[model samples]
Target: MDWKDAIIAVFAILLLLSIATTYLVYHQQQQTIEVQEAIIEEFISARHIHIETTDSAEPPAFVDRYGRVSSSIVNIIAIRSDTGLGEIGRVLIEITEGDGDVLVNTEPFIKPLVQYSVREAVEVAANFTGTNVSKSDITVSFEINGTVIGGPSAGAAIAVAIIAAMEGEQVRHDVAITGTIEEGGYIGQVAGVFEKAVAAEKGEITIFLVPCGQKQAIYYERQTEEIEIFGFTFTLAYYTPREVDLGEYMAGKMDVIEVATIGEAV
Candidate 1:
């Protein structure tokens, strides 16, 4: 081939490579973002979600690459007790509405990630709740386990929901968190609190939010490990599991308050 033609071919090849590289790099980054967001969204929604639209002088901007957004919401899980006979009762979580303008949308490109369900509390309660030798005499209280990573941790999200309901403020995405909330409203430690904290730091979160009471321990542990708190503010508060009413929590009528005990939330 002529020298001129050969030079042109090389340039064309170089241009194609540049375009392909850019596409691949962007695609990979997008895939990573999608994966992480899915993990967070699934865990939150798997509990209960409350989306609320508030009348504000100025609405909040969209938090992500998604479209212009306004609104805030809480993801929650509800548990019921028939007779205070055991550890917990039946637990149910649904996505409802919350206060504020948090954008809600569906993406057609993302696939749902497969997650493990928390081992039912019933399996753990067989030893605690049997009344008589007869099978019918046995009663069981439903409980949820969220500390087991890769499994559902609606328990933690439920605590946040209760907190939001009491405080009357929507928990936004700006804060990253993870934890397990017990029936007593105590923020129980989880397997990945530190890892999740690191992840949030990597995301440039200004505030590291988690189930309350875990802050001192997490902060202390991070300090010993030489991990920086990343200039993020940490707020920890209890979620009233029992006294916190899901119905009212969803309605946006509840006050933004801290829950002292899970028993009080119900």
Candidate 2:
């Protein structure tokens, strides 16, 4: 081939290479931006940040991450005896670094079942969740306002919060989770599914975590309506077990994520 023809072919190949390189670079940048946005979104959603939205208003203050949750509170959904309906119960926790002795409030006010659950939570978080807390100098204290909340169901949330607080990791604030943390680190399922869902919704929780197999269930509710009549009044009520997807229940409201282990949860 002539030198001129050969040089033209080389230039064409070079031009094609340059175009491919430019396209690849642009694609990679887009992917990087997407990943960064996902991280920020995860961080923000985890904390359930509440902010006002307006065209003229500034965005809500957001920190990259958070450290050990102090007074890290989680809600427990329970059935109210009086109303025979679901209600939201609160659990408040405070953890402090101490001198190697894990202290928990086993007070008389605290139910015996909850006391056991709390201790189990401390042990699981310390040993399983990759948290390196000085067991010799840490204290865990919690206050329970509702009696209906019992069993190891709260173990997962309690353990993770303690670990997060000690490790200075951020616990998603907008999410509420329910499950019992097994001694072996398996997240065990708990009862009160219907009531818990109701309670979670009432609390305005955006994400609700449940154990595997517990993802799909039935929730029954009864409503009473009064009708005025010509000479009297009629009251009508109905109840049924509505089939629903745990993640898309409540009229496809909040997210109900099913987690099987501590790793998935964290």
Instruction: Give model 1's TM-score versus the native structure.
Output: 0.28
lDDT tens digits, residue span 1-266, model 2: 98767766886899899999999999999898678656754553343211222332221111112323244556555545555565655555555433334455543144345555666676676665444344223444444444444355677877767666555455776677788887766888877776787778878878888888887866676788998644447688988667667665665677888899877887
The model with the greatest TM-score is 2
Residues 186-212 of candidate 1 have per-residue lDDT tens digits of 444443343344444444444544444
Model 2 segments beyond 4 Å from truth?
Answer: 1-71, 81-84, 99-102, 106-108, 129-148, 220-242
lDDT for position 164 in model 2: 65
Clash count of each predicted structure: 34, 15
Off by over 4 Å in 1: 1-149, 152-154, 162-168, 210-266
By summed lDDT, which 10 consecutive residues of candidate 2 come out lowest?
A: 56-65
- What C-alpha lDDT, on a 0 to 100 scale, does residue 96 get in candidate 1? 23
